[model samples]
Target: MRRAAIVGTGAIAAAHAESLRALGDRVELVAVADVDGERAAAFAKEWGVPRAHPGLAELLRAERLDLVHVCTPPRHHVPIALDCLAADVHVLVEKPPALSLSEVDLLVEAERASAGRVATVFQHRFGPAAIRLRRMAAEGVLGRSLVAKCDTLWYRGDAYFEVPWRGTWDSEGGGPTMGHGIHQFDLLLSILGPWSEIRALAARQARAVQTEDVSMALVTFADGTVASVVNSLLSPRETSELRFDFERATVEVEHLYGYTDAHWAITPAPGHDDVAASWREKPSGVVSGHRWQLAAVLDALDSGEPPPVTLADTRITMEFIAALYASAFTGTVVKAGDIGPDDPFYKSMEGAGAPWADAR
Candidate 1:
């Protein structure tokens, strides 16, 4: 069995523990660590873990762990993941894996230096519906992909930002674009492939935070497909939705947080009844969450291969976020290659402060 540990004791960490438990004999929850000693011990006891430590360094020294889930906030992801990789422990980090492209590059370097690999948690891609959609698209069942819409409009009150790191670029990255909508967009990228450019606008419409409460972008994929993407924490009626319009049909998934096969639907275009039937015939069973992704990660480790949501795969999503910020700040279209070494956005999502800084 693969011995695993969780690095945070927050709600998300508990979810990770639950999923690890659901994996049965494939993985063992050996330890849990939190900065708060009491919280760590309590979490360990609550989750039936064998050990608890106040910090990862102590846990690393004590346990022979095969994997460590970095469930800490966005700022700590890179450092924690790097530490785990250096100790030859595979790492599965939460969303918005690193604050910037450069930080992600550092983790990539560490992964190259170590025997173990690093994977970002993009569980949305693991759902059976997502898998089937990708397969159908590859097999030409979707025909020529055209326009698409991706929305992650969820509500977050000002109280949510009372946590010191919640809204700052130094910690949470960049509001809804990085924290909320990323899951849906990552799934979109997984299906549609690399994005070429983005034109975007960001605003602090409803919340008083360092980052924008909402952002919208027009993304152009390398294959000539265009998508309208929106990330918002101001919406009253929350929903996570992705719709792809193809030559043969319109395929969509509507849900909040994780999704199963039932959340997905396909509407065939005129004379495309066969495509709709085929979509229904595709495999079903898996639901996207920590459990499914963890299974894949453990299997990859067992087979001595890089896991799903690999650094390369993660870079695509990170680049898109960078481009979105860059476009919003500069009021110009940003391309995939635009935010490289010399780009200000490469190091910070604020890009020399947001364009609306003066207004705010």
Candidate 2:
């Protein structure tokens, strides 16, 4: 069995543990680590792990680990990933991969520097519903894709922001865009391909966070497709969904319970009367993305191949995120292919914890 170490004993760590445990004969959970040593120990005990460490380096240097699942908050991503890659250990980091494109580039350099792997955890792609959606779209079920509407409306109270880094830009990155809705945004882009431009508006409409709790953007894709993505942390009941409309067909899926499946619905528009027929097709999948994502990672490791979510794909998302910040700040449409290394916001994480009302 391939040995693995899970860094970060946060709430989300349980899901990762549960998923990894399910892969019984394939992977062995070697250790659990968190900044709070007690929390790490408790998590290890709860999951029946053999060891626990107070920090990532301690775990890495001590354990004979082949992989590290990074479940830490956004700010620690780059640092932890650098440490892991430097040690030549594979990594699967949680979403909203890093703070900046520059940070992502650094990780990419490390991955190249090592004989190991580094993949951002974008588990949504593994969801059966998502898998079918991508399959059908690529098979031409969606004739000429035109528009996509991706929405993430979930609520988080003050208690949710109790963590010091929860609502800050410097640590958690942007609010909903980078935090809660990042997976959904990444899924949408993964299905629709890359964007060419984005016009955006963001604000702290509902929460007292350092970034926009709600935001919307108009995006134009490289394939001449137009899309709109909206993210918010204000809904009473958490709902995450995506809709894609095409000239011949349309595909959509909704999850009432976060990225993991509570349910899914994918419709293939009919030949003549499309929308009507679409309503007739049934949806499938009722499992969380956690399991499939973990499985894919193990399989890739065994096969000596890269994980599905590539760093370049992640960089694409970050590049677009930079565009959103620019457009939101300057009140102008930001072109995607236009952002370059020379841009002022390129490495502008200095004072990053400031108001997210404007990043430009």
Candidate 3:
């Protein structure tokens, strides 16, 4: 059995522990580590993990682990992942993998030299409905994807930002665009292909944070499709939604956080009633969550293949995020491949800092 350890024991770490428990036979949960030693020990006891460490360095020195889950804060992701790669241990890092494109490139280079691979946690793409949608779209069952809408409108009050790192550009990476809505838009990118250009704007309307609480973008895909995206922390009726308007039908999923088949629906255009059958043919009952994704990661290790949400796949989404910020901050249209090593945005999501930095 493959041996695994989690590097953080926080709220999200519980999901990782539960998933590893679910895949109990295939993988062994050997140990855990956290900055708070007492919390780590408690988590280990609760999860039945064998050992606990005060930090990743201590855990690495004590264990011969096959995989490490980097569930730490945004700023720590790259450093912890670098340590894992140096030890040739595979990593399943949580979302917003790195704070900036520069940090992502650092992991990409480290991965190239390591015997193990890295995968980002983007569980939405693994759900049965999303899987079926991708298959249908690829088979031309959906016809040309004309337009799309991705919205992550979730409410987060001022108290939510009290968590020292919750609202900062350096620690949380960004506001809703980086922290919340990325899951929805990443699923959108998996359905549609590469995005070409983006024009966007961001504002700190509600939350008193260093980052923008609301942002909007108009995106143009490489295949000539256009989309509208919005990430906000001010909506009372919270929901995560993605809608794709293909020539044959419009496919959508609306859920607050995680989703099952019940959350998805399709409405076919006139003379395309057959589309419904294609959507229904796929087996259901799979919920999008860490468990589904962790299982896939283990399967890949068994087959000697890279896991889902590979670095290459994640960079596409990361580039889109950086471009969105670049567009919003500069008041100009930012395109794919527009930000390279020399561009300020390639090093920091805030680039030269947000336009409203002075106010903050």
Q: Provide the lowest-lDDT 10-residue window in model 3.
A: 277-286
1-360, model 2: which lDDT tens digit per residue? 999989988988888899888998999898988999889888999999999998987898788889898998889988998898889888888877798777888888888888777788888878766776676668775577888888888888878888888877688767787777788888888888878899988878767667777878999998888888888888787888888888765666677544433355444455546543543456454474777888988888889889757788888888878778777766788887666667655664222233444543
lDDT value, candidate 2, whole model: 0.78
Please tell me which predicted candidate would have the highest TM-score against the true structure.
3
User: In candidate 3, what are the lDDT values of residues 127-235, reduced to their tens digit?
Assistant: 8898889999999999999999999999998888899989998898899999999999999999898999999999889788999899999999988899999999999
Residue pairs in collision within model 3? none
- What candidate 2 gets wrong by more than 4 Å, as runs, is 258-262, 266-286, 348-360
My TM-score estimates for the predictions, one after another, are 0.98, 0.91, 0.99
Poorly placed runs, candidate 3 (over 4 Å): none
Query: Per-prediction RMSD in angstroms?
Result: 1.1, 3.0, 0.8
What are the clashing pairs of model 2?
Answer: none
Task: For model 1, name the residue pairs that clash.
Answer: none
